[model samples]
Target: MSFQEISPADTAESLRNGNAVLIDVREPHEYGAERIHGALLYPMSTFDPRALPIDSSRDVILHCGSAKRSGMALMRCAEAGVPINKHLAGGIMLWKREGLPTIKVDPATGRVFDPQQG
Candidate 1:
């Protein structure tokens, strides 16, 4: 199964408009360090395609720190009979490079921190 790759900016916009669901396939620690705001945690290490929210009306976009992990997740999903075809082209690294916003999660308290506020 092939997947569609979207730009970070486009993905952000789609997410803001509720046109898509962003799934982050990175590890928990990586998610805590930095992640696209509003992305759902679905780490590849413990990924369960069946556990993913199924909403045919909404588009699902998977991503990781880079496209590598997300790509792997896509394959896994396909193998499991889960049809996920969209992903952030370059992942969070590209998202950051595109000047998009991300929230840093406080591991201890699970609080979200503003990336611009240091």
Candidate 2:
């Protein structure tokens, strides 16, 4: 079975509840530049569920620069037995657009982005 898709807020909430997995499909370089708090590195182009931490019973959420790639990855992972409960609607760009928390990765020093509070 395939996984369910939801908004970034729901996904983030799932993560906060400690019951979901967040997989960023972007490459290491891109991921290093910016990523969600608990998201892991699993580029869809090169990831094989049989190799990574994928388990059919667990919740898995895939993401990319845009929802396009993540959607594709979600389908593929679902076909590969990634569990029907897993959630994946899109990428982090939209999540940021929603005003959710995000970390910007710096290429030079590899620092995370944090706009200080006023």
Candidate 3:
């Protein structure tokens, strides 16, 4: 089954409008390092598409550091008969390249990173 892919900017817009749910399929450490604000953690290593909450009212968008894992997650969903709304075309890398806002947490100190200070 074919799946839909959305651009990072469009995904960000959908998220801002509360019309989509962004699921990050990367590992916890990766997520903690940097991630799109408000994205839900669903690591691909231990992901169960069947366990994903189904909300007909909103779109479900899956993503990872790159598109590889997210693409695999989409296949898993399809195999499980779960209907995914869409996925980020190029994942978080693309999102960051687009200059979309993200939340960065320091794993050691649990402090938030200031983008401007970087």
Question: What clash count goes with each model?
Answer: 0, 2, 0
> Residue pairs in steric clash, candidate 1?
none
CA lDDT of 26 in candidate 2?
A: 83
What tens digits encode model 3's per-residue C-alpha lDDT throughout 30-56?
Answer: 988898888899998899998886799
Point out the higher-scoring one by TM-score: 1 or 3.
3
Ordering by TM-score: 3, 1, 2
User: Model 2 over residues 4-79: C-alpha lDDT tens digits?
Assistant: 6778889888888877778887888888777788888888669776555655555667778777777776677667
Give the candidates in order of lDDT, highest first: 3, 1, 2
lDDT of 2 at 63: 76
Q: Per-residue lDDT for 27 in model 3? A: 97
Q: Which stretches in model 2 have alpha-carbon errors above 4 Å?
A: 1-3, 55-58, 84-87, 108-110, 114-118
- Local lDDT at 23 for model 1: 95
Cand. 2 Cα-lDDT: 0.72
Taken over the whole model, the C-alpha lDDT of each candidate is 0.88, 0.72, 0.89
Q: Number of clashing pairs, model 1?
A: 0
The TM-scores of all predictions, comma-separated, are 0.88, 0.78, 0.90
10 residues in a row with least lDDT, candidate 1: 109-118
